[model samples]
Structure formats: C-alpha cells, structure tokens
Target: MTYNKRICVFLWLVKGGISVVLEMLGHVKLALKCVTERERIERK
Candidate 1:
C-alpha cells in the first residue's frame, strides 16, 4: 500500500511539471505571435 501511494505521488508530480512546462511554452508562443504582428504593422 505504501508503494502504491508513492507511485501515485510521483505520477502527480510528473503531471504537474508537464503542465507548468506547457504553460510556459504557451506564453512563449503568444509572445512570438505578438512580436510578429507588430513587425508586420511596422512594415506596412
């Protein structure tokens, strides 16, 4: 029972870590898009 609990905790940590990483990636993508749009407007 203890081993099973440990495994569950480990999985939860992994899932949380993945979500944080994905959120960071999403922010980066949004920033890139904003920059691109600004450059396009400046060009015109």
Candidate 2:
C-alpha cells in the first residue's frame, strides 16, 4: 500500500510538471508571434 502511494505521488508530480512546462511554452510561442508581427509592421 505504501508503494502504491509512492507511485501515485510520482505520477502526479510528473503530470503537474508537464502541465507547467506546456503552459510556459504556449506563452513563449504567443510572445514570439507578437514580436514577429510587430517587426513586420515596423518594416512596412
């Protein structure tokens, strides 16, 4: 029973970490796109 609890905790931690990483990646992607669009407008 203790071993099963440890496994569940490990999986939960992994899932949470992945979600945080994905959220950060999405924000970075949006920021990059905004930067590119602003640069294009400046060039025009």
Q: Please name the candidate that would achieve the greatest TM-score relative to the true structure.
A: 2
Per-residue lDDT, model 2, residue 39, is 100
- Please provide, for model 1 over 1-44, each residue's C-alpha lDDT reduced to its tens digit, 9 standing for 90 to 100: 99999999999999999999999999999999999999999999
Candidate 2 residue pairs in backbone clash = none
After superposing candidate 1 on the true structure, give the runs of residues whose Cα lies further than 4 Å from its correct spot: none
TM-scores of the models, in the order given: 0.88, 0.96
**Candidate 1 displacement at residue 4 in angstroms:** 0.8
For model 2, how does the per-residue alpha-carbon lDDT over 1-44 read when each residue is reduced to its tens digit? 99999999999999999999999999999999999999999999
RMSD after CA superposition, every candidate: 0.8, 0.4
lDDT of each: 1.00, 1.00
Which parts of model 2 are misplaced by more than 4 Å? none
